[model samples]
Target: MELSRRIKSLPRYLFAELDRKKQALRQQGRELIDLSIGDPDLPTPQGIIDKMSEEIRDPRNHRYPDYEGLLEFREAVASWYWRRFGVSLDPSTEVMALIGSKEGIAHLPLAFVDPGDYVFVPDPGYPVYRASTILSGGIPYTLPLREERGFLPDLRDVPSEVAARAKVLFLNYPNNPTGATATREFFREAVAFAREYDLIVCHDAAYSELYFESPPPSFLSVEGAKDVGVEFHSLSKTFRMTGWRIGFVVGNAAVLSGLGRVKTNVDSGVFNAIQRTSIWVLQGNMDGEVEGWRQELRRRRDVMVEGLRSLGFKVEPPKATFYLWLKVPEGYTSRDFAERLLEAGVVVTPGVGFGEWGEGYVRMALTVTEGQLREALRRLREVKL
Candidate 1:
């Protein structure tokens, strides 16, 4: 059978070749220090696990969950947003559950974009933004995030004609490949732009809770943002709940209604047990536990940043997130630099894998331990660029 046209139009998997090489090395008994993906190495807090254990045994939870999520979970989210961001949310009207932020982000284009419509998406962004737009038969209009601009997209750069047809604008901060954060002023600007173009603003704030310095502001916290967009957040990064597959979207009740409609038809809601456990995590007195994670992550970040800088690699210690975006050594492309690291039995994501504008940089995740980072540093020192 032939693949559908949309499936065939998807971009090639850039890491497939790198993955094959890794497997070959593994077969040869070579040890590799992989620092590619941004999965947290920390375990889900014991409190969350214990809470889930209790919820899973409830007979009622075995039934399919409410499509909009349990009212209690949504209330907890509303409360948490108020406490953490000073942002008030109407649980019944504005908040809805997601299997994960990725699921919601992937389905959003389906609800708003028509064939050949434009979606203003950040380049070097989470691949889901571009992939989902394409899958929905929408054109992805690139919003280039260059280093000179602190990696924030310049909204004014979009042609007026392109903006006129754009149906959505996707943003992420602290960003994925680049560890850049956006200011409230920038978010205000985004809101105005969305209003002018009549676009749905999709803000992926999955990394907001993983900050090292000041807490990152939510797009919804900006005045009038709720008039134009919604923000997607996940328990994955903050609670080490990546495998739990639970998250939520808030703001613009009308936009959330569209996403909820798509979700109801496409798949069942998040498991009730998981949702209840997430509520426990959100409502519990767990600030100390989360602070502990931040401490560990900060230590790991320092070790990696210091080690890379000593080796003459141009990298900044990110103020948020566990990723370090490094400029590849001169005369070598991002793929070449990553491949060289692989030869040294170390793995880093080539920035080009994110998008065309990501070339000349490599992303290193701090999910590995300090000891592994030290060992990787030693290996990196021997690689000739």
Candidate 2:
């Protein structure tokens, strides 16, 4: 049996590879302290859960839901965007529900990118961005995101030829792997670049609500961003609803419609009960919930930063997202360092898992309890990286 050429070219998924190693270690009776994935250990708010429970009992909700989503949920997302970012959207056309932001990010290329068309992807980006592009038979132009440039790819640095064939550009901030957040000015420039190049901009704002000091900026906040851009938002990070698989894509009507068409062919819709719960999560004033999570994350961030520093590693407390992007110590690759940490009972993601440019660093997610975090730090300090 022959496999598809496109599928053959793709690398094994980062987390899947990590899971294989983790499971092997765990099977050996090693108590693995997993900090590799960015999954929140916090519980979902009770209000949202209660709403889901009530909706689940309704016989009507058991039927197939609309592919676009429930009108109430769409309207709630629109209203949330308007109130949170002051970006007005037409719920009827500009908003489409997704199983999760990852679904949208992975399936979107099928809607807009033709085979052989070029996509500008960050070198140290979330792997799905590049994998999706490859799976669609589209060429991915990796723009190296270097520390000197604040982990952002400079559009001006893109070669003229690559820019000419580029149809889509992917941006994420409060970035994964490297928790670098983009400023409004940078986003404005990106919007302008997309407009000038006649490219579609896909902004993955999954970590928008996980900020520490200032709220992360939405792509829609920039002037005319909606003209050439679509942004993906997820309830996973914001409302601790990772398992719910609810998220939204907001922007140009044409792009939303195209994505909706792709979705209709592949998936029916997210569960109605999840949609109703999402409506409650978005519309209600969950200020207390947000504040509580932020404070706890802040304390964890300080401890991890200080602990890593004491081990003679340079680590900056990320301004947003619960990840620590630490540079690999001398003479060790990111993969090797990660393996060493795992052997010492700590599980962290290797930078090389994200991209080649990410090879010199490692990402540690602060998704464990304070005591567990301290214990991981102690074990890390003993490891000879």
Candidate 3:
């Protein structure tokens, strides 16, 4: 009863491990105000729910969906890209629906990376990027992200040997854990680097619609970007449809086809009803509703930033995404700080869970209600930093 070697190399999932600790504390009758995971506390908009209900009753939808996706859904995704980022996509060959952006990202490595190939990933990034690479039997080369560089890695710093063997580079802007956004100039440099190194760029733009200032640039927005990059978008964050499991990938035709090949073999498609609802969401029918959610998140971000600062933690307000990445107080490891915070009835994620470079930070998710956030802050204030 031996496990696969790939499965054996995987580290324990941070959130799952944290949940065990949280459950233990809750069993002791401690009221835990969890801010660890970035799941939105808000309800799905009525429009989206109503759309799903309507589709579910239509008997035709009971059949398995197209392996690519419903044509209407793909068209809506193409239209959204053109309107939002000026990136034109052909629904026929350049777009494919995903169960979620994470599903697409995780499966893509299997499409492009062979065993023993290298996949460059950002340290202090979402763990799935590295985990997926490892699961696909590709070696992961961590590119350290530091605050001194605005949390963006400098590609020039990568050793020539690593770049030579690399097949894919994973990047996320309006980044999770750190909440850092990339600029157009930065993306231009990345595009140039990828061209020189002959690597495919996998850009995770799940938070594109959640920004506070300027909209984050998509990899497809750059000139000639489609030649070497693929971008993934999700309805989870933007439309508050995390449970719906709908997203899309658009960019290089070859890459999209590679992902499609893997998908056809592994999945039927997203549920027809969910794809129908996603069409409405992407077509701006839900814009007002989504905007309202954004405003609420913006307010929560302000509250959390101010509250943490008042408690003597140097917290920077995130420009995008509903996360606050704060340095752990002096003399405490990120995991130790997270554990202490949990003991204080506030559940935050340890930065080390993201990567070794994340060791000195803690990520606080503003996914709870304003009242819950205030209480969590109050409890945090009582703890000595």
Candidate 4:
């Protein structure tokens, strides 16, 4: 059998490679404390589970779902967007339910890009952005996010010629692996940048609801943002519903329609029962419940950041998300540090797996219990830099 050229373009997924290393250590009977992935370790809200269980019994939800989604679910999404980020959306044309934000984020490139088109992606970013661009046969241009720029891409450095050929630009705030957040002013600047380039912006706001101190601002909260972009929201992190696969997109109606067109031909929509439960959670006033989750995350953040700092790693505590981005110790490359730790029964993601520029760093996810995190830190102490 022959493989497709598109399938050949992607590198091995960063997490999958890390998992292989983890499994090898497990075979040796090592007790491991893993912090390699950002999957939440918390339980889903009981109310959401009850709602889904109840809806599943109804025969109306047994058939294939609407291509767009259940109408009520779409309306709840618009209402939630307005209440959460002050971004008003039109339910009928501007919103579309996704199996998850990742599904929409990956498929969107296929809908808008041509084989020769350019796609702008942040280096040291989530692997899906670059892989999806490659799968769509689009040329990917790397935009470096240095610490001096607060880990945000500089619009001034983006060449006008590249922008002219680019079909889409991806930005993620309350970012994964890096744990960085973007400001409203930054989003406003992005809106102007996308407008000047005559291209679409794809903001991956998956971690928007997982902030520690303040809620992260949405790209759509900026004035004129709807003129050029759309934001992908996920229930995976926010609701700890990673396995449920329910999410939605809000912003530029035309771009969403294009993504919807692609989705309609590729697969079925989210299960109707899942959509109904998501709608219930959205409409129920979940502010206090979500904030409680953030409080728990904040406590975990303090423990990990302080423990690392005590061991002499110069890392700033992240204001949002549940990941820590740390520089590798002196004389050790990212992979060497990770490999050393893996042998000590602690697993982490080596940064170079994200990109060439990520070579000197490593990412630690705070998904483990405090006791486990402390155990991992103790294991690092044994490495002694």
Report the C-alpha lDDT of model 2 over 155-208, residue by residue, as the tens digit.
999887788899999999989978899988999999888888899999999998
lDDT of 4: 0.88
On residues 214-264, what C-alpha lDDT tens digit does candidate 4 reach at each position?
788989988999999999989899888999998888899999999988999
TM-score of every candidate relative to the true structure: 0.99, 0.96, 0.98, 0.97
Best candidate, TM-score: 1
User: What is model 1's C-alpha RMSD?
Assistant: 0.8
lDDT per residue, candidate 3, 54-131, as tens digits?
989988888898878888888999999999998899998889999999999999999999999999999999889999
Instruction: Give the distance in Å from residue 131's predicted Cα in candidate 3 to where it truly belongs.
Output: 1.2
Q: What's the candidate order when arranged by decreasing TM-score?
A: 1, 3, 4, 2
By lDDT: ranked, best first: 1, 3, 2, 4
Model 4 scores worst on lDDT over the 10 consecutive residues at 12-21
The models' CA-based lDDT, in order, is 0.93, 0.89, 0.90, 0.88
Which regions of candidate 2 deviate over 4 angstroms?
Answer: 13-21
Report each candidate's C-alpha RMSD, comma-separated, in the order given: 0.8, 1.6, 1.2, 1.4
Candidate 4 clash pair list: none
Clashing pairs in 1: none
Which number leads on lDDT?
1
Alpha carbon lDDT at 100, candidate 3: 93
Least well predicted 10-residue stretch by lDDT in candidate 1: 279-288
Better of 1 and 4 by lDDT: 1
